[model samples]
Target: MLRKLPLLVGAAFLLTAGPAFAHVGAGPVDTFSHGFMHPLSGIDHVLAMVAVGLFAVNLGGAAIWLVPSAFVGTMMFGGALGYYGWPLPMVEAAIGASVVVMSLAIAFGVRLPTIAAMALVGLFALFHGHAHGTEGMGLGVSFLPYAAGFVGATALLHIAGIALGLGLDRLGNMPATILKRCAGTAGAIAGVSILAGWLAT
Candidate 1:
């Protein structure tokens, strides 16, 4: 199982690294489905979302729930700000940095107090939510339903990360840790790529 971890992460990277032109049409339907699919449309969102779950798992205890909860709550707030056309400077850079930092946290097995972890996660969520909100609103979708859909989708992605973390735990601490680090390394590489793209633009 541990030996295959790299391959799994690599496959995920490949699967998500393609042209993100699909997101251009994400709001075309202006329905719950469109909102739900928005996060999954970008590799950056997926990596950051999944990395949050993995980070929580590494932290253990109340952090497992609190961290993600903070993220969801703050994300909604951030989305509202975006919907209102509020300025959030450096959103794209922040989002890319979030992936890099969170992935490195997992890779190094960094543990923080639950509050600190929540803060870190919440900060990242703000950028992500702002991006989603700005994009969704621009498409003329109903804000409430679109928010609900994307929030639900984000939760699902976190759950997926939790599930993966749990599966790794079954392999015992050392191997699981190694595997997670491999996954994080992949995330870091992805983050660098994302940041580069933003820089180029």
Candidate 2:
């Protein structure tokens, strides 16, 4: 398990990238059960979800939970906003931008005040949650189970990010510089992809 850790983490992008965009919003779902599965249908959601965990590992301490917590809490808020038709402008673009920006955070190891970081991430989660709600709406997907699946899967991804991050700490005392570069590059690419998606959509 230890030796293969790197390969496993590295493969996240490859596995996630495939058929990731295959489903942005819930295309179809007869039962409420499908709502729970919608988040996994897209790569952007998967990567964004995982990035939260990877970043938490980097931040450590209360952050491990705080960050993800903020995401969950705020996501619910976003969902509520959507449910009520709050009228947020440029919602799709915002969602894509969140993915791009957050990816850059990990890629560059951008140092931000903890409070600021949480707020930034939480804001992004709102867009995420809103999308989830909108996509799964009236799809027969159980709200509870759907939220659970989305949150649970996202948490699992975060754990993977933490594990990989810990592995990096042990492997070679890898330079922060290097990690930032990789993260930044990945983020840039994600951002571009998201931008393309927005344009196409």
Candidate 3:
């Protein structure tokens, strides 16, 4: 099961990396078109969304809903800002950081106070929303449906993480330390990639 986790995660990496890079510097339609698919659009989004899922599954109970809800709520707020042509500082940096940091949280068991976790995830969602909002120039698609698509995709990734976490359950309460470690390592690698890209640009 543990071995499978790495492979599953790696597959996610292969799938997301290219699309994510394309997302940077795109026009409204490009942003909107891809942003509509953004949660699954790139590796960074995938890792962050999956991290939320893993954290909830590991936390159990209310956390399952709480974490995801916070993400969606904050994400929507961020989207509104972008749709309205608001300027946000460090948007890409924040998005990349969310991926690297959250993945590490899952991988390394770097549990934060529940409030902290919510706040952290919320921050990430802002950039995500911003990217989505500005992508289509506020006219490429109907805002409600477009927003719905992003939220749905985010939820799907969360579910995938939950599925992976549940699969870990079969290992008979094996220490989550291992899973955390795996998540952290992946986060680090992803973070480096994001940083490198940011630097180049």
- Number of the predicted model whose TM-score against the real structure is largest: 1
Displacement of the residue 101 alpha carbon in candidate 2, Å: 1.0
lDDT per residue (tens digit) for residues 1-201 in model 1: 334434533443343333232222244435678778878877877898899988898888888888888889999988878777897866766777777778877887778889978987898888788876776655454567767888999998888888889899999989998999999998887786776663221
Higher-TM-score candidate among 1 and 3? 1
Candidate maximizing lDDT: 1
Higher-TM-score candidate of 2 and 3: 3
True-structure lDDT of candidate 3 = 0.67
Please give the RMSD to the true structure for each candidate, in Å: 7.4, 8.9, 7.7
Q: How accurate is candidate 2 locally (lDDT)?
A: 0.62
Worst window of 10 by summed lDDT in candidate 2: 12-21
Taken over the whole model, the C-alpha lDDT of each candidate is 0.76, 0.62, 0.67
Candidate 1: where is the Cα deviation over 4 Å?
A: 1-26, 136-141, 198-201
lDDT of 1: 0.76
Q: Write the per-residue lDDT of candidate 2 for residues 27-123, one digit (tens) a residue.
A: 5433434655566666666667667766776677778778877887898888767655565645555566666666666775665556766887787
Lowest lDDT sum, 10 consecutive residues, model 3, at: 12-21
- lDDT score at residue 39, model 2, on the 0-100 scale: 60
Clashes of each: 0, 9, 8
